[model samples]
Target: MLKNPFLDVEFVPDLMWFIGQFDVYDREETKGAELAVYNPDDECDREKLIVKYGLDLKCLSYRHKFVLVRFLGEKLDDPNFDFQSLFEIGEDCAGSWPRGEWYNLQNPKGFLQDVYVNAKKVWKKDLEKAALEDPSTW
Candidate 1:
């Protein structure tokens, strides 16, 4: 049995929208074109990515935030895991945001870590709670 009452309730657009922002999504759509031009070493490129993702940092609901920061965090660390095989991006994306999490960032790892560092500074308690607590309990 699960602890969360909303276990069956899907965190859709929030979750998928989060994943769709990074180069990971573009890598799938553009045949690795995003991976080719994305230069993480470039300061301008890095800053651009930071601002892009940072703007939408608070858009995620609490549960959705954890789902992104934690699981996506894991995916960032894994070179072998291919989440694209299991999921696909398409035309009908949700949310009120104009862009709807479609940045095609240069570096997913840097984007995540940078966002985590900045987010941890302001949302320390919330981020930490999500980090420490097991998702199974949520």
Candidate 2:
């Protein structure tokens, strides 16, 4: 049912090594952590579809964030819903970069566990380090 044949494959590790950099911060934090934006367009071959829906290597490490973005951009083949769009969605769900509180995500409860919750789980250590280090003067 998909137009692009490549967007139907499974995502692998090589397609998700970008999240090793970002650290998730909670509310009330003065400073936030920096994330390495991985633009696969620069590193990998475009013609070859790594995942069925196109994976954003940048959000790979943050499982919840990555899944949420993928959910936001279901139409991976649509030119309007490509990686950049996913980045936008990620920013939307995860709040703006440099530690802004524009769209803070709520922790998931009930059956559907929120992606941000899981993402924080993966980046907790890094986020802790960033929080304790202080960001205003830096």
Candidate 3:
């Protein structure tokens, strides 16, 4: 039997996890709970596809990474993720795990659009491979 090219709805979390782990932070410097997570912090699930295949995850996390694979070949065929400004916080990881935030965008979802504009060139091969591989394989 042939398999579907789109991502299975159930795989959303894994795809998100493949990108990185997310956490909400309540910072006085920013209103509401600020979203944060370290990029490519695969400590939780490093044995997944990208790692097994030896492709670099790079600094491009969920935001930019999602574009090439289309949320694992399912979402953003039109490209509106419905996120905010999207800032890259935490200049220093301080040598800790899982780095920092996830979404936390106040600028506009379009900011990610700008990043996606060049995503294929940046993560073309790696994204394609990970998207095609079974997350449960590991």
What lDDT does each candidate get? 0.48, 0.31, 0.36
In order, what is each prediction's RMSD in angstroms?
Answer: 8.5, 18.9, 12.2
Model 2: lowest-lDDT 10 consecutive positions: 105-114
Q: How close is candidate 2 to the true structure, as a TM-score?
A: 0.22
Error of 1 at 91 (Å): 11
Candidate 3: where are CA atoms >4 Å away?
A: 1-69, 72-82, 85-107
Which candidate do you rate higher for TM-score, 2 or 3? 3
Top model by TM-score, which number?
A: 1
Among these predictions, the greatest lDDT belongs to 1
Give a tens-digit lDDT track for model 3, residues 11-114.
Answer: 22223333233322333233212222223233333223233222234544433354435643443443654343223445563211222333333332333333
Candidate 1, run of 10 with poorest lDDT: 94-103
Q: Between the candidate structures 1 and 2, which one is better when assessed by lDDT?
A: 1
- Candidate 3 has a TM-score of 0.30
List pairs with backbone clashes in candidate 1: none
